[model samples]
Target: MAQSTEAIFIPHHVDEAFEVSYAEAAPDFGPLARDRIPVRSMAAGDLVALVEIDSRITGRKRVKYFERKLQDALSESDVRVSLVAELDGVAVGFIMARVDLGEFGRVDTTAVLDTIGVHPDYQHRGVGQALISQLLMNLGTLRVENLRTEVDWNDRVLLGYLDRCGFRPSQQLCFDRSLG
Candidate 1:
């Protein structure tokens, strides 16, 4: 793992059939399923299925809005969103991320994992892990300085996963509310 003098190992994850050349990243990766689930970086064709899954799971489905947003994000160079884990070629899980090569405050540049979600029925399986790993791989390919995610303080499962994936507590938090 000898990197150049300025080369830094940015924390990232992968979500699909990661090439074995990056076996070391395997620790942060997981199988989508044992021959049952097929992991993939989603494409435009999956719009319908993803919408259906959302409606069935959360009862709050907005297909066209999301489709437009996805299309816009992909059209942008600074944002790199990778959709993951489609069982039977149907969209079941996804990871959305952004890769920015601009400094936040003092640091140079970074990639941030914005959102990741799997259908509730598909929970407990490794779909989420696979999605995460895949996103990290994408970030690595871009030479991102680091990968970051904003987590709800109460999401213990997510917190544990991020810890296992080698993220540290880089900042603290404060909450605010506005009332009329």
Candidate 2:
């Protein structure tokens, strides 16, 4: 896939705002070993696998959601950062992410971790870690400054996993207003 060539700009006043760079703040974890499972970029052919894995995890099939996610990953963004994990030739996990060249008035290059899912049978394995490791490596090459994700407050399992991956609470608080 082609990459964007636009110059990403960061506000000069960020330091005065006490903003922390995700790249510098993240703890240095040792290199990941990809010997066990093979992680690769998402492809148009893997749509079925992604849908299947997600369905098994959430206990319902959200076909349209996964379809749109896959489409966005493959065509909507300038960069393709989403990934899939396979074992014995079958897809067992997936992580879909996108790069934001800038948002609001700030122009820092950041990646948003949109959706991640591992088949029920593959939970507790190193599949998630491998996916995350590969993602970090990819982001580093593109000079992405940070990775951000949102999790429901009640999702203790996911929160614990993110903590283990060295992700801490973001400095900015998120506020949402319901339109309903």
Best by TM-score: 2
Show pairs that collide, candidate 1: 13-133, 13-136, 14-133, 14-134, 15-130, 15-133, 15-134
| Model 1 agreement with the true structure over 64-123: per-residue lDDT tens digits | 766875675577645555666877655678776666676535455677676566788887
Clashing pairs in 2: none
In order, what is each prediction's RMSD in angstroms?
Answer: 8.6, 11.1
Supply candidate 1's per-residue lDDT for 115.
57
Instruction: Compose the digit string of candidate 2's lDDT tens values, residues 1-180.
Output: 123354545776776657654443333332443447789999999989998998898888888988898999999999999999999999999999999999867799999999999998988888888888888888888999889999999999999999987788988888999999
- Compared with the true structure, the alpha-carbon lDDT of candidate 2 equals 0.84
What's the C-alpha lDDT at position 177 in model 2?
100
